[model samples]
Target: MKFTEEHEWLRPEDDVIVVGITQHAATQLGDIVFVELPEVGTEVTKDDEVVVIESVKAASDILAPLDGEIVEINEALPDNPALVNEDPQGEAWFFKIRPSEPQQMDEYMDEAGYLALIS
Candidate 1:
């Protein structure tokens, strides 16, 4: 898994990358009440806003970490947004993307680096 400075995490699955916010981000957002995910087939560029999340504290957008095609989304989030607060790095993942430039992932931080950043 790799982490971005924006607090997003990317895990490389079989042929796709699973994307979601880190636990630190969920904690900062407070209680999540709403989620707006992008369409599965949508094409996205690095830094594009792909997921919108509303929390008690504020609304935030999850940016695309790499150029890719959104292939799948967590359909459960719209109905149970609190799952983001519950299991941010696991089941609450926002989407899976098929990266057009997989090597872009190398630019992100490792777990140790991310922890240091937040610390």
Candidate 2:
């Protein structure tokens, strides 16, 4: 997945779309306390705020990557937000989506492209 400074990450995998926070995001967010996930089957639009990840310092919204219905969420994160801190690319994933607009990925950067922006 590639990331933006906004803390959104997007990865296309077959029929499903994987979404989450970047490692830089998790580090900046600090110690997380709660994770508010959207209900499965809810229709979401591109760039809409879908998840709320709260840290001891502040609360931040996680924006949806593309327009789609939320197929699933990471149930474990609500109880353990540190999973995001522990493994931003693994167990801490925020949600799984089936992007309604296939063109969305084309609008975003590749891993190298994103790294260039961050670097």
Q: Evaluate all candidate structures by whole-model CA lDDT and list the values in order.
A: 0.97, 0.84
> Considering every candidate listed, which one attains the maximal lDDT?
1
Candidate 2 global CA lDDT score: 0.84
Per-candidate TM equals: 0.99, 0.94
How well is each residue in 1-119 modelled by candidate 1, as lDDT tens digits?
99999999999999999999999999999999999999999999999999999999789999999999999999999999999999999999999999999999999999999999999
* Backbone clashes, candidate 1: 0
Alpha-carbon deviation at 55 in model 2, angstroms: 1.0
Relative to the true structure, candidate 2 reaches a TM of 0.94
Clashing pairs in 1: none
What pairs collide in candidate 2? none
> What stretches of model 2 exceed 4 Å from their correct place?
none
lDDT of 1: 0.97
TM-score attained by model 1: 0.99
